[model samples]
Target: MNIFNSPQRKRLFQSMKMGWYNFAPIEEGTGIPLTDQETPYALYYCHQVLPQTIQEIQQASELVGSVLTQVWQIIRTLDEDTLLYYGFPEATIKLVKYDFLAPFCMRLDWCWNQEKGIKKVVETNPQTPSFWFECTDGNNKVARHFGLQEPDLNVQKTLKITLNQHVNRAALNLGKPVTDCRVAFTALNNAEDLGTMRWLRNYLESKSTILPLEYLGIKDGKYLFDQRTKKPIDILFMWYPVEWLIHDTDEKGERLWPALEQLIFENKIVIVNFGSAFALQPKSIFALITDLGYDFFSNKDAGTVWEYFPKTSLSATAIGNSYFAKPILGREGEGGFAVNSGKISVRSSNNDPWYTQQNYVYQELLEFPKLEIDGKSMTQVWGAWLYNNGHDKFISGGVGIRLSEGEITDNLSYWCPIGC
Candidate 1:
């Protein structure tokens, strides 16, 4: 039975096409397109999990968030040389040191082997985590279509409150009311990135604007401005990755990143997912935490690290076989590979030199629960979101599931909604 060609699958696709799921079109710049016969992006299916599994995932996400929070605290106190060793670009070191608070939102990628009851977090995306629309509204629509109960029903509400609260706090910190703040949301010109930003911008209760990354510029090396409106932006909520943002240049190839960094450092502009969040984006942070050992962490945090995090090292050879090698600043599983029995088994096709040329971290590989979809086996990776509720408190926002044909969940992974 080919599920993709089934009647239910067709109906599900139609429902998604007519609803808020904007990433369905093959030519919409949402993601990598597939052959005409296959669904290019989201799967017209919902994967149901036990209520206990949902609770466990939420609890584990909060614990991992705490450990990362502690690590970020230590990272902020480190000197330049130490930060450079951990893959922080020297150009943005000063900006990363001037901390604001924990990132407003982050997503931890996890591999959950239900049969073995093992959940291991692989990496953290603190800078620009996507799938916001897919996880909340899209998940609800998919669950309703299948006549199943949506897990985390209040996720949309929670996200609205969290985002608005963060905006209000940023406004207050800037010595202005929320109504007076000009919050600009920018992203590359693409469906997925723009859609995610637009979705998030709608939840913001402050005065807000949306524009493409190209329209954002710096003036007089003091503040970032929207080129279109010719007005200085106060708060920037961008989908651009910090690692890449450091290298941004103007039309004449003059580097503008330094000025942008300076603006944040001088308190001329506020960046959500603050500049310091870059300290948490590197894959090497995992290796750094593991190397720090039990003595560096509180007893409870040490236990959390050992229980939830995969053993990571700066050297692939140190992990021997059965390890995953990932570039320190890799995004969307780019420049990553897996070794099995001392032989390279799975590797990402995206050999983007920007990521491939960077340092790599080797991590112990964990088993991923598999499912048969449309007559092919797919590996599942669960994404748990961590949100900061404006009071230095961390909470699990929600969970989303991505399925891929290979071990690596890349840009083309299917967005399979989760049901309780």
Candidate 2:
């Protein structure tokens, strides 16, 4: 079923203003109210639970570190080319495919007071895990009780620094005389992954000059080279659709991709394209999964699980993302659907790649997990992670709660941060 098209969704949208924080609809401007009942409620709930959540996730982080250590050891012993197939160069790429830590961050968060003392993960917006819009809606509620600043994504500093290091590296590579290159930039068009892209850009541009490409027209298919000084346009940190570069083959059988490829390849413009590379997605991931277990259904094999998920309606090609529409790469929940040879198919991105022969069991739909706030259905949690180029660590950052009456987990969710 199309979760967005459901009558349930109507109820969900109606509650958007009040759902995430239990904040009153009137809390938008005029400064936060003093008697807001939502403030005490949100704090009480977070205080009661966040402490324990933090401890558990810290342990989970260590577990992931250990697992990566072992996986790296074993995988490194493989054939040279085999190692590359697993995205050794692009850590996030390999990570987005089979890892769950980054994903868990967006979905979970808590505070820890053990050896760290009041440490907390602010967010985990791993994918399109966006909250800026919701951040605006809930600002008054947060400011009233929580005392947070407006237009905040509630991101953590560790994550902010980690991402900035990458941007700074690109800037340095652009041979900056300090003022020659801008640190980061964002787009106005809010695509699916646009939220995550913006977070990193803002984080990287922290204390740096960041101008939108549209603001300067510096990105209109032009080089950064100074026509007068003969200096190429310095590093341009951008997070745009990869589609822009390859919209179509050009007049001479070339594509815009080649231009971007040249810019990036030649290091003419230092860029961090976050959209297309949100995570490591290899075309071979599905086939690699099939070799490990469950018969990854093609259009020919989709009837097997199409009923479990329905929103996925892409006509999968052999070499594109459709290949990941199987049950191995990752979890697509019960909504994403795709088309096969002659029929429609349902698949998930959360394919485990390898499972024992009898370790898995296919079951019917079970009851949905209920998470209520103030006697109303409202809330979703998105975990965030960072694949730092500097320390090369996947530091789990924060958790964002998206509120909706129906929590099937989709675009219409509301985002709220955890604390003071």
Candidate 3:
């Protein structure tokens, strides 16, 4: 049965304003396009998962969060080879020394098949995870149009609480008054990233500002500043990947690592979703934890990891012939591929260039359960945002769905709101 309504699509297009993108009408019987003119995402569908599945996902997420905390504790103890394998450059090893604390905000993406009873996590983004506005604001709009109601999880409200608490703690640690703290939320200049930063800045407590990555720089030797205003940034809410920052070079071909090192070591500025995010960004954490055995995780946490994390190996060829190849640090289905009959079948459209230089890990290839929409077979990837409030509290902010026609979810995948 088709759940899409034309009137609803018109309302979403007019009200949501997904930033200049048009949601083209979904053609009846044909699969939803990667994009459409009438909505920022494929509008005709809002996927639903069993309430039991949502409960289980939250449980698994907490377990994974605990294990990740353990991994952070032992990160420095890992041999140089293991550390380097996860893409930590030689110069950045010092940053890993402060790993007792984990990032406050995170998202875990999973491929769950109900009929086959398969639920495997693809990756975890400890620091910068998008889809907040889409999931909380846009998804709710869509749900109401479909006469659906989700229990009052209130994702955006939860995010505000998480951000407010983290910012307050950061202010305290920096010896700065929360009232005087000037925080900057920064991301790349791209539309999607900037949009996310904008959305976050709206809810951020304290005096907050938003800027593009290009406008951020180190000034006066040790202070992280906004190049646009020449003002020092007291706290930074960075959506940009930290690994890239560690490798950043100036116009003169000099690595900027020294400037960042000083800023961090001197505590000139506090960064939210701390540098520990780098340690969890790579897919190898799952592999390492699995190889290190259940000793690294509590018995229950260990079971969750084994059950939800697919067998991941550093080498793509090691996981038999029909595994999925994924960059250790890839995002948004980029640098990912599926192998069948010794041939690469599916490749991510948004594969990052940096991933080409990094190692790839292979995991067992599991198919996603399909849902028929408008006579088109569609699949979805379930993403749940896990926010650690920096106070030993793990909150499942909410869940969102990425709908796609292809085997791999990519940048253009539509946001399908989940409802009970």
Among all candidates shown, the one with the greatest lDDT: 1
lDDT of 1 by residue, 323-360 (tens): 98899889999999988888988899777988889998
Q: What's the C-alpha lDDT at position 240 in model 2?
A: 40
- Model 2 scores worst on lDDT over the 10 consecutive residues at 355-364
Model 3 segments beyond 4 Å from truth? 1-14, 20-44, 99-101, 251-253, 316-318, 341-343, 349-353
Q: Kindly give the number of clashing pairs for every candidate.
A: 0, 41, 10
After superposition, the stretches of candidate 2 with alpha carbons farther than 4 Å from their true spots are: 1-48, 58-129, 132-155, 175-180, 190-233, 241-245, 248-255, 273-368, 387-389, 416-420
User: For model 2, what is the error of residue 204's alpha carbon versus the real structure, in angstroms, after optimal superposition?
Assistant: 4.6
**TM-scores, in order shown?**
0.92, 0.48, 0.87
TM for candidate 2 is 0.48
Q: Report the Cα lDDT for candidate 2.
A: 0.37
Model 2 agreement with the true structure over 78-116: per-residue lDDT tens digits: 454653453223323232232221211122222222343
Two-way TM-score contest, 2 vs 3, winner: 3
Error of 1 at 32 (Å): 13
